[model samples]
Target: MEPPEIRFQILYYLYNKYYGGQTGKLHSAEKIIQETELKNIDRNLINGDIAYLYSSDLVTGKRSIGNGGYPPSIIITNKGIDLVENIINEIIVNILNQQDNRIVKNKIELIAKSDQRTRITKIWGYVKEKPELFVNIGEKALKLFLSGGY
Candidate 1:
């Protein structure tokens, strides 16, 4: 079985894709798997992960009864959205503290103040336009933050 953290990542990814402007949206399991690039993972495993989130009140969805295609749709709860946003804020603050460059720090601060949706978009824009700005953050940390992990 995958670690619990991996399962939790599903919740985070859902928040990034569907929260904020798209709040309360219900998306197909197939669409979610494709977006997160978890297509190779078994449908049952995804169902188990969704079940875990559901049990935690972080999500609402139907899990396929067997190991076949994942049925129905999924929605992230407000609680789940808050959880992901809080983690992101913590990560941004940590990155800002570690950064000595004033310019980089300011940029990160701006991104942090924005809504979750805007933050992700801004971060990616920065990454693509000014890769050098995030050199001090370390690749692993940056990747984690970008991939919906703290």
Candidate 2:
């Protein structure tokens, strides 16, 4: 069976991108949802994810006055980063062991040919419009993945 998706992944990605190694940085839920490209993630799911993260001592949220009027901004802790790293490592190892190199290559090609390409293209447009926000997020994510023991 496929392992459940860890919400910490999205949290860590945000933390790493915006917090610059700090434990807590105020980020609105709407911003997080948009930045993470969490397609169709509802309010209930977001609330549940935040609750789980908070319970695990991975993230903390606070009320903030922003464009969204009362959005809670969340910050990630060191524990969250560690959790995300572990999950990513596990995924990389599993992928490396279970799939042949050719299969992996083909899958990447297929992804490039299919929906991911369009999605990435759209993200690129946003990035171009707001270069400062997405500056190193993609590069950092790629670097992290490549440095793993895949």
Candidate 3:
């Protein structure tokens, strides 16, 4: 298995797109990078993760090779879907069973209130339209929150 945080992010992105009417449609590798915003994680690392996920039969897809392949993409297998759901359910149960889980429960509720796909899509669109704007806005928002604007 991959590192918990990295694995969770990858699975979450796949699950979101899979449920967002994409079905078996392939998602470009570039799109995956953009969606996950894995700046701190090397692209090669994600590629390795993808390869490992594939070897474990959790996912199946294609990769861009040289210049002939043109574009790259990936698609989750049914196994991946099942595994992700199970992992998510287990995580929820674990959190709920934790002592003094009130704060974690609240955070979960906050996340559940939003449509993840829409939020991700908007952010991805912004990145493509103006990456500098996206970075600046995120920094500004975080700064504002730190300054007690939340």
Candidate 4:
């Protein structure tokens, strides 16, 4: 299996490719194989990478039927979309140094590196005082955070 970073890369790739994680869009395994940076990676490894993303709830797809098989379709979940958008937003914040965007890009980088559970825990701790931050954590948690929906 590839490293956790590879899973993230695959997740980000699918998010961008599939209209920023719009639900219900499905693509063949071949398209993913031929188009992404992971193209050169062994098919089995890519399968594993996708599996990792699936387990993390960053993607939704069928499991490969047998050992070392590729899943038939791939779709980035809303959670995955939120992750990528959050990172992008954080970068924009860093570049503009705007007063409203309180988070620095470095924190976003760290959040990107961490798993979903860990990211939520850290963010929760950081903003525990602000009860509004908890509103979207149920359905579109990360999205609310990035959009300042709270």
Compared with the true structure, all predictions reach lDDT values of: 0.64, 0.50, 0.55, 0.56
Model number with the top TM-score: 1
Model 4 weakest 10-residue run by lDDT: 133-142
lDDT per residue as tens, model 1, 17-101: 6745666678776787787647788877777666656766777766666734333677888877776565556557666777788
Q: Can you give the TM-score per candidate against the true fold?
A: 0.63, 0.54, 0.60, 0.50
* TM-score, ranked from best to worst: 1, 3, 2, 4
TM-score of 2: 0.54
If both were scored by lDDT, which would come out higher, candidate 2 or candidate 4? 4
CA error at residue 139 for candidate 4, angstroms: 28
Q: Which stretches of model 4 miss by more than 4 angstroms?
A: 1-5, 20-23, 67-70, 91-150
Q: Return the number of clashes found in candidate 3.
A: 0
Q: Give per-residue CA lDDT, model 3, range 50-137, as digits (tens).
A: 6656666666776456623223566777876676555444433443454264754665445444464543444434334644433443
List ranges where model 2 is wrong by over 4 Å. 1-6, 18-23, 63-71, 102-150
* Candidate 1 least-lDDT 10 residues: 141-150
Model 4, 1-150: lDDT tens per residue?
Answer: 234435545665676666644447777667876776667778776777666556667777776667343357878888877876565444333333532344544554565467644554454344344435333332243333323242
Backbone clash pairs for candidate 1 read none
